[model samples]
Target chain A: MKNQTVLFRSPVPVAETATIAGPKEKEGPLHAYFHYTLEDDLLKQDSHEHAEIRLHVGVLKQLLNRAKLSPQEIDCAFAGDLLDEIIGSNFAMRELDIPFFGIYNACATFGESLILGSCMIEGGFAERVTCSVTSHFATAERQYRYPLELGCQRTPLSQWTVTGAGATLLDKNATSKIKITSGTIGKVVDYGIKDANDMGCVMAPAALSTLRTHLQDTGRTVDYYDKIFTGDLGYSGSLLLQKKASETGIILHNHEDCGNLIYNRIAQNVESGGSGACCCGLVFNGYIYDQLQKGRLKKVLLMPTGALLSKTSSLQGESIPAICHAVSVEVIE
Target chain B: MILNKEEQKVYKKEIKDVAPKTKHISTLLRAFFTGGTICCIGQGVNQVLGILLPSLTEEDRGGYTTLLMIFFTGILTAFGVYDHIGNFGGAGSIIPITGFANSIVSQAMEHKREGIIFGICSNMFAIAGPVIVMGITASVVVGIVYLFL
Candidate 1:
């Protein structure tokens, strides 16, 4: 272990992954990669929150079904969401029998869960663990901004929250080429930005900080992996990260953001791009995982970034603090 | 890394430089046309009402026109059309009485799942509450000034 990063002695193998994307996400570029797509975001549920819970539960069940494992066989489940008090994950856990550890790092929750799940296996505490995250557009809008039906225009920098859920089943003894090699836990960085709508500006500093630290700790260069995936930093935020990284002598030519890749920003009418806890979750489990399995991307660093702010905090005019966690997943030759 | 005040200011300036600037001229034009069209519709409604019931006073006609506008806004909100208009029109759609109706109706419809008492009724004014508060305060102030004058 070096600084904030942990290098697993024996890399934890990813056994199976499942993704359930919403109708809007299904229209995106990675539509075919998702395991399942919901025609209706509500999924016949009355509210979006309930629909999110259903999506979360659906992805977990799909993971188990695909891996041929039962809830009893899984040692523990690590999950989180953007809902108030993380009720999406809490209510979904009610239907399952697995031990649950609810985690929250705002939009970077999936990375946190992945790092924590790998740690559990590497520490000899668990044999098989499931990591998952869920986020919904409607639920997030009502909680963070305004009512879903409100007649309001989105700001130029505003990001559309992805309505999706993704689950990854990690096993200690599984024979899988794609493995969690190491992870760098991020520190919360605040630059005193008070604009709630401009989340990209608020989170870019944190993403840059984590990327710099990860590279320094691992003695790696900018060409370390095939690509460095940042979570939910929309088009502008990604540019900001690249520019700031270059100023510090780190060239990020092979950088991609889950937020920018998940949707067709111009066609879909998304101001900047897709965001939320599930932005990276859906993209990784659906698209990136498929690519890795196909040997398209040999080694990659997954950095999920998050703007840690609540409605109360923003309302009280507090500056937004952001965090990012990086996990290196590679195929063992 | 914790940035000092100077660094924070510099970073904020950098963000401002990178963020896409809002097209003020186009937005203003859109708002003008949308708001003008909405007012024209209200006037058309008032004219039709006057032709139908000539006995009604101007005050009554104005009240009925406002009601008709709210009713039309409620329908648009229910069918999820006003939000698109709002997106295009910006403050044009939001500054009119239709905007007020949309704010209330949208909240009511969104919170309908939570039931009537705590959800729809309480949250209907969530967005429009500040406007209502300021409107009443200004009216009270005006009334007091008139009395003293």
Candidate 2:
């Protein structure tokens, strides 16, 4: 059986997020998001909350304002960031009147939140929900995977996270326009690919399987949507996704994948490809919404894939298990 | 049988075996040291990467490269190279995301021998799937407030 469902997506344009910071002169190493040097005085305090968390607050606040909503109106905040205690989202949301629930999805956090917020709204669980996520270069580096200061040259398959955050508003108002239709959750898949330098290969088969199942379960054809967006698959992952999807009979050999676009603007900075929860988040908020408003696209399917692994598990010597979730969204006149 | 060259060498002699008492102690020491070693390596890497790439390290970002280490580690684990690191490092391997990768594929291969469906062929995210769900759910709840309010 094929799956068929439609969603109402927003067309809100994102503003230039608040702050992008690097380590101080005597503080520490810099991040991979930008190459700009920070003035020493600002970097001096390094501050009460980690400067990283503070920056996330600014990004979140900026997006919230753009959505034309005030923080006090939100129910519980559905926030996730790539930090230990989810300090960025957790702390930032603390000042708000709503409750907080911190999440961790590596890069899949954004999609995960959207699905949840949509479900809650659709289920009568809540109204006017928001989904947001943040990832920092240094915080993520030090956690489950590796260090930021490694100074190691990135491979052609590597990606850089956009130093940004993305948040979306989901409501049940038919008048508001965008609708949340249906979704298909993915299971982890491994194609026996095992080169750390080649994530696209490792995760490609998983993304392919999920997309096929998602389409099949919904009983929908490929032509149903204006665009099909993915999480942080980067260049190799996107190419591999196309190759694998072709074998499955989906024939997506010529379409655009979001990860390919997020880093397109900063191609020279990355190695193999571009990815990060922010890659899709940035492009979606920064570009996709504006295009939709301009009538360039009417509908799109958003799918963000996640590779699940933990520091304890990595040390235990395990292979990555991948998952993806699909959401269909449309703009109504 | 005659005892020995000397008038009465016993043909058979009995000796009492003494079991080593350090077994438990060794086990605990191994666990503690192995765990410590893995943490040290991760901390070192974190310090170095954060130091070298100050721009990438100090702030929150949503981009492609924030995950080089996670992505790279996933690849190494798939290649069987990371498995070796696990075997040698033991708890050190188990303490990081690379260890999680090793476990998933190892279990997948073990079940694969049973046949794809009944065996290694189950959810690719069998082990880590829940974490993804919960992580996303938690974030959604928090993000709703951050964005809406």
Candidate 3:
């Protein structure tokens, strides 16, 4: 379909959600928000790959438990991770035993999963579905950049990859107040930014494109939502978005970036704040979800952005193409 | 709505202003002092070796000094001490031979769980492999020059 907008006829309720993070992430500003925090990044697993899988399994189990449901009760599972071949999600699905749909949009996997999960329910394909995404700093570092032991100095433009996993269960008939109302699938937008270290520069334009498109298609303005959240744009990209939005007359008065909100930039040495799929996953599933439950947030526009560049492509001097998926969540009193 | 060429340039400038600036002064100062201290220590060790091994030739003494530094660094890395020093010293600890030793030993320790042959032995020099390769290549070039001379 040429149309990117998918306004749902039936509102999908997020019945339950859970988030798990490493010690560093738990020590961040949103420490009190997460459901579980690991003492170490590895979760006592031998390899980071295994630890990532464990994290995914942990969150899924917690979400299922909290919803008072089992894996067998889930009609489908939409999950992914920032791993080559999506092995982390694949490994986790082996234990999940649910019909799995693996997705990969780099750091935007969480939003992609949410959009698809909402589609499946709205289309009456499934009554209950679980949407999840995982990212571990160790795994992503070794895969994309360097080994932890290398002690390579990070560029100021770079962001710390988040070590966390977040999962949410959506039910068609659930009595939950928070509901997914609409979604806008993002197109691949490239600004020809080649520096992999400055991913925020590569992704900000994509976030802007998606946000603008979503607002235009819905015939709504920024004030239509209580707050607008962009996933993993960090400090620089978030500021750039605000600048561009103001220039285009789309003043985002209550805008927050998951990347900037995930960590205390001054206290933690997170140069440009946090990145990776878990940035939005943890922030949305933990903090934003809590706000919805408390009736504090009536509606929110979540635009999780992703820089779609493989290590091979970046190494070969290719510019990063970015994507963002926006989902409108409204609390149904 | 991808930005055009001129718009990209304008946006890039804005991004540069908004981006976090690298802390060069503190990092440079830390690297300078740390690197200087390690070099000073090397000189001290060289002097001590000269007195201890008076019978040995100057080149042999130099070799012994290098070995001692590497041994010291290996021990520090094994005891999880070099990591702290490296964190604090930044480029200083890395510019010395001790830094080279720390890299290999730490990588070996990290992969020790994968077993001996593949994990420890094979992957020990994964990070330092480039340095070793370049060192050998450079030495071969010097050897060729020496032959011509």
What CA RMSD would you report for each candidate?
0.8, 23.0, 2.3
Whole-model lDDT per candidate: 0.94, 0.56, 0.89
Interface DockQ per candidate: 0.80, 0.01, 0.44
Docking class of 3: acceptable
Fnat of model 1, as a fraction: 0.73
User: What lDDT would candidate 2 get against the real structure?
Assistant: 0.56
- Candidate ranking under lDDT, highest first, comes to 1, 3, 2
Estimate, for each residue in B79-148, the C-alpha lDDT of model 2 and write its tens digit.
6466555534555556555455555665554344346777555734556567679989999999998998
Give the distance in Å from residue A313's predicted Cα in candidate 1 to where it truly belongs.
Answer: 0.6
User: Per-prediction fnat values?
Assistant: 0.73, 0.00, 0.32
Candidate number with greatest DockQ? 1
Interface RMSD of every predicted model, in angstroms: 1.0, 24.7, 2.9
Looking at candidate 1 chain A, the ten consecutive residues that score lowest on lDDT are: A146-155
Which digits, one per residue and each the tens of the lDDT, describe model 2 over residues A1-333?
A: 133232323332122222233332112221232213244312333432365566566665654575566776666567777666678788877666666667766667777777777666656667667677655554554454433322123444555554556666665553544555666656666443333445544555566676777777776777888888877677667766776577667877335655666544243445444555655565565466656656787777777777666666555666556667776666766
Clashes in model 1: which pairs?
none
Q: What's model 2's lDDT at B128?
A: 58
**Tens-digit per-residue lDDT, B1-149, candidate 1:** 67889999999888887888888999999999999999999999999999999999999999999999999999999999999999999999999999999999999999998889998899999889999999999999999999999
The CA lDDT at B105 in model 3 is: 87
lDDT of 1 at A221: 90
